[model samples]
Target chain A: MTPFSHRKADTVAALGEERLISAIRRWLGDVSPPAPLGIGDDCAILPASKKAQAITVDPVIYRRHFDDSIPPCAVGAKLLKRNLSDLAAMGAKPRAAVVALTLDPRTRLDWLEKFYRGLAACARTYNLAIVGGDVAQADKILAASLTLIGEASGSRMLTRAGARSGDWIYVTGPLGGSLLGKHHRFTPRLSEGAWLAAHPEVRAMMDLSDGLAKDLHALTPSNAEPALDPALIPISPAARKLARDSKRTPLAHALGDGEDFELLFAVRKNSNRASFEKTWLRHFRQPLYCIGNFVSIGKRPAGSIDLNAHRGYEHLR
Target chain B: MTPFSHRKADTVAALGEERLISAIRRWLGDVSPPAPLGIGDDCAILPASKKAQAITVDPVIYRRHFDDSIPPCAVGAKLLKRNLSDLAAMGAKPRAAVVALTLDPRTRLDWLEKFYRGLAACARTYNLAIVGGDVAQADKILAASLTLIGEASGSRMLTRAGARSGDWIYVTGPLGGSLLGKHHRFTPRLSEGAWLAAHPEVRAMMDLSDGLAKDLHALTPSNAEPALDPALIPISPAARKLARDSKRTPLAHALGDGEDFELLFAVRKNSNRASFEKTWLRHFRQPLYCIGNFVSIGKRPAGSIDLNAHRGYEHLR
Candidate 1:
């Protein structure tokens, strides 16, 4: 088989920038709530009175996180977005972030501008400002990492824990090989996370950067299993292309191909009835779906997907 | 005459750790901060209010930052220490830090532990916590970067722009090389920075990761000349060792060598007199030397010790 599966995973050139960003911006357009301390500046500006804070860090490698074929601006923007997405996973608001950039001379200044453009594009859109960071030229590869410092607001700050049996499991945005094209351009669901945290129904929340199966397992409480409906997943065209071969590799891609940057949340069945309302629909331009539900305290989901979870690559495994 | 300077710059290994950390801890130890969100945990936990917040990010590379022969653990600790020192530079109390580690598998975990041990050693003594970070495997050389997050208490924050002509230029700990042998293990002056921030006299501030010459050039405001006394610059054993061979080369090491992690600040004359107090018998572990004074606007000091003004080995140059 050809190493690259164009059918299963598409890119920005294919998705159309308007469609991709429109789909994303619709869900996360507002600014963070005013806080005395936050990750938005050089040092957190949060008020002196809050009890606790939330912080998360993420490192973006060149080929591992994204390909250099993409512009530098996108790389810069997405690096921050990746970390911001982690804070969103914890149901925390974006405060401020620190960036460490290891630059490669192979990347021209124009590329760096584009990189910052992508970064500024995200930060400006979300009202998150670039504060302070280190910059240097590298002989090897270009790398950027962001560490987001945030505050929990009043939400106890959700985590992989706090999920319940029978809770409806859902995902924000479409899924599949975001890597095909979306890897360098995916928008973090920080705004959606803030909204969800404000609502108090986002029992367990996380960002699915590492694919559905592995991420779901991470979110699943240690003692219980997660029951999912393969048919209900919000598969993107990328994943659909993967499955076209009928070898089941595509199905695994949908469940395993990582770096999607989508938010996966578990909600109590009784309280989630209003999730499909007009008010809620405003939070996302892409269709949202209930892929599965949590099961009783029992065995974990034994295997991944039907296409042979083992057939493909497994990182942690 | 080598293409590059035969002299090594003032680096961490040369400064010796005991002298460095002791000076810093004594200054800022009054602040005992805690972070379940530690400097190593993932991210720093700072205060949060009901508003938007801020944080800063910086990255450092190894050959570009220090010589490659240095131990891996020291490399690890230095990465985090540099970031923490940035927080101190801002006069912001450190909350925590997040790291991004990228290197080949050739990078030993044992070295990584020593790095963490150095980081932990510095973090504990500095009262800063390790929060969280990211790690990656790469093919080329090693790269470790950190995004340190700190809180500004309120709106009282320090910036480089705050420096003015006639502000007594001050530095925490000695100038010159600390990286010769112990560069990796040297601590950033996080504590002294916080204390100086609390004090009214200290004005603009920054850490001396880069040598005094290059860093001072950055600190010299308004195009004024930096006239310095070569005799005033504090010389370390590493610097002395480097100087012993070729007076010009190692002096360049003391001048251009980066990764000292010492605090460089501009304080008003007489407002904080104790900062410069040093007797012949008493060793000011982290001493602020009056190497040079800020000249009037428009004049560059002809004799100022130019750490970077002198040509040296290019880390990333």
Candidate 2:
């Protein structure tokens, strides 16, 4: 724990909103290809881009998204990474983001400063401008909502609805048990997503956010359902470790654990699978796994498990 | 007071997040020129635009922004209007927005639906697209954060840094005691702002949110301070009503009460004030007032009051 965390007098309420905002601004520093107008103004002015923009908003709330065990920096990084994953899913290059934070007045100023530092580091790494934001006082909870705007890589952008029957479903890396640490620490599969989007053979694509079991349904068309091979699912070591102390098996955790933040996409069935895998391996260090295929609704593979029997994390449940 | 507000089984927890999101999407309906990809997608795709974009984010929390007396619809409207006011300050045209809402599980579904209805109504009124959004469960408080992307009216957009000494400061409408319904119901000065930006004489502009006393400082350059004519301050009827039972005078309330979401701008020193007023009157039904001028520090006009003595509402104070 930081020294100031234990000091009651060093809270945000004691320092005041204006001072806190100034500290946050200082922590964010500057952005490359600086915005026409940035923080301190009513709005940040973004220059016109030739490519279509992809916009998304996601929030991390205390307890729901993180707990006291998580460092302030991880919490901040998680917020940006989660939104970045959304952009990755759309095969977009992150351009700018605006964040709104609601904090309990008693939150330590040190924690807030560290959070901004982590957020700034992530923004710099991604070359995304921290454009404009607002801070509000909340009664007890702390929450941060980030809206990321990115530029599409090409004319066509990927969505969850484009998967066709017989398309081979793929995941960029291992899945499940993200709660151990990977949930906030994992890197977003941005380059892989962009590469996949550029490939003509790649069909529908989305980031694995709420786990394969739940998210796969999104990529499955109304006339089809996802059929997964139990042996092919890339269950993570974390999922296996978690299964040892839980009632569920490793495969169950791999199928149902959310926050994997990996790229889940579909490629045309007619594409040369071996050649595509070779190209993907050349471009990315992350392992690629062809876990399943989208099949006509009532036609099930001989030994494939029933996806409808599994469930993933659901908010407000 | 809605039919479902008092029903115990009608809460968001009972209804679930997915159903509530579908209801919100239905409430928002469709945009005029439909987006290439919208809600339900990982990210909403916004077609390329020639005009520069202005981005901003602001959030409204349960008690900080509204109270039990304020209807859910008003609460939702207030969230969007606040962000709209920021765009108005920058003289930008509304384009698209993504909202992230954190709601207490026990919040009534009816209230949430009404809130979205109000938000959708406001978005439609401005022809702004509700592109995408996310929902999370909060421990207790209900909060909504909105990130609005708007198109700059022209090549150059207004900012608080453009004010010069001797520039006259003007306000678009009455100020203070916005708590009496005007805070949420007041129209954003969008058209007026665009008009001012198009005019060659408007030097700087910003929306008055934290009251005239505090907000004017944003428009005052480093070399100058704001000089106000007490009689010229447009004290609202609500200010006078609140003043009757308070220690502060109506003028004090006008200067420091805050949440007066009116446009405050600086006009060039040599601009023909009479001609400008006539043009403004011909364009808008809302009255405009020339409050004062920005003057070099310590060179206050004989009758002008010292702005340093007044204070406005500050969050987390």
Candidate 3:
């Protein structure tokens, strides 16, 4: 049979991009499209406004980054949050996002409605716009990736490599249990990141995605660095459950489970953590922790993920 | 089985996004990252340079975009082209791109190598850099979506809606036959677009993606005021084969076979097509045509996609 003949979207229900494209054409009418072509072309190109810089992209997987029952809407919200989080991580203001969805054919419209509702609500929450996106019918499960466009003056941007060895390491919020608690609802910490970038004392920064241990390993000085304490990890209620159920240490999950969207950063050593917290901690509705400090190279394994002596998420391993 | 487990990526032996992410992490160690968080985060957040601005997104499907026989390298190139075309359409100079990959569990490392190789080649071709992307594993066919970032200065970006009545219509290279030719290789006419945008006399513009009929139909002013000559349609060599083989008219194939990545635009009635061709046409090896002109709409079926008269690729009926 010709490839096109067996091209039923249901077989690939959640994976084939063509099947999703077909479905989308029916749902999205001819968008008089402020840009050029809207849905059918290879790319969606829009005019960038002088008032706004433009975009960003955020990708996600089911088991690795989020839970399955996170509610499609919340899942949708999470995807946008993560994307906006990246812009936030860069200290950029939100503008718009386009989603590329890969899903199992079984994905009902109700699920999608909730998903968009959740995602759009978040977009509205941030005042960002959803201009366009595509959907794919997958074979068995659902997956999605979002590309967002945000605007920021060049000087306001920051990077993770900017931290000096003498800088102090600080986190925007408590960094564990993201996968266990309400990860779907976590704010991108955009304001917090932009705020920190505006503050000269904020040297280097990164969002805590793959747990404190591995992420901390990321922040260690590139030239050389001291090791961190495995015992000092702050445990979260969700992390404690991971430990209890899996029979592993809470520190392991705290350092591993991932999906923690908090910002892990370095600031000058003399900065008043309390004073900063007093002004911004209320915005997060959660607590930020100072688990360790940035130190110069010492006599230890460059730095250990310490996995609390447990394993972190490794695909091929 | 659990939701995540029920949809394990490696089910088809495609190896899924898990294995893919692992491979990429090892391949792309921290380069001079342009963003706050590089590959490891939910998204790669590039700190925007105030001097530059533009974001474009292109979603690629499996059967609709590429075939299994397509070399992995070509697949990579196709993904990049999709987004690059968007930037070209906007008359934006290409800069950076973020990829969102979703593939069946059966995908392999060998496949990824070739894919990345081709994508790398495109990056070199366009001087566009790969800033960041996300990978996910699914059950069914494979697909990818890349969001390209771009920038333009002093020039006002071009859009599809700028064409005016009595304006002369023109196309860049050849028209039709995308199925057999290097329709996949046709780069967006960004350089020409930039030149046209600089010339105020160059009215509305847009790239030909959804075939001449639909795309041109889209270019017509709202309320539909235009008359098209069926005989004016341009046919490419590849389109000749598709028509001859399919027992259809060459004009129909050119009108339906989308993916002829040529620029279809309108310029002032007095504009010199000869000079524009001399400066730009020499670079192309294909035939460019002036298919038709805009007219005041009489009752003649306000210009539109004659789906019944011509056809192109369709995902589902």
lDDT of 3 by residue, B43-160 (tens): 4554435544555566666665676656767777878776666566656677777777665555555666667777777777777667677665544546778777676533666667
Interface RMSD against the true structure, candidate 3: 5.5
Q: Per-residue alpha-carbon lDDT of model 3 for A141-177, expressed as tens digits?
A: 4567788777553455655666656566677655466
> What is the lDDT, from 0 to 100, of the residue B206 in candidate 3?
72
Candidate 1 - chain A - TM: 0.75
Candidate 2 matches the true fold with a TM-score of 0.97
1 or 2, greater by TM-score: 2
True contacts kept of 2: 0.91
Docking class of 2: high
Candidate 2: the clashing residue pairs are none
TM-score of each: 0.76, 0.97, 0.80
Once fitted onto the true fold, the runs of candidate 2 whose alpha carbons sit more than 4 angstroms away are: A1-8, A32-36, B1-8, B31-36
Kindly state the number of residue pairs that clash in model 2.
Answer: 0
CAPRI quality band, candidate 1:
acceptable
Candidate achieving the largest lDDT: 2
Ranking by DockQ, best first?
2, 1, 3
Candidate ranking (TM-score, best to worst) = 2, 3, 1
Clashes of each: 90, 0, 26
lDDT of 2 by residue, A1-317 (tens): 33134355888888787887787788888752233466788899888887889999998888888887888888889999999999889888899888898887778888887888889899999988888888898767788998999987666678877789999999999999998999999998888878888988898899998989988888887898888999999999999999999999999999999999999999998999999999888988877999989899889788997988888888886
Which regions of candidate 3 deviate over 4 angstroms?
A1-56, A61-68, A103-107, A135-141, A151-155, A164-167, A223-232, A270-287, A296-308, B1-52, B104-106, B269-287, B299-308
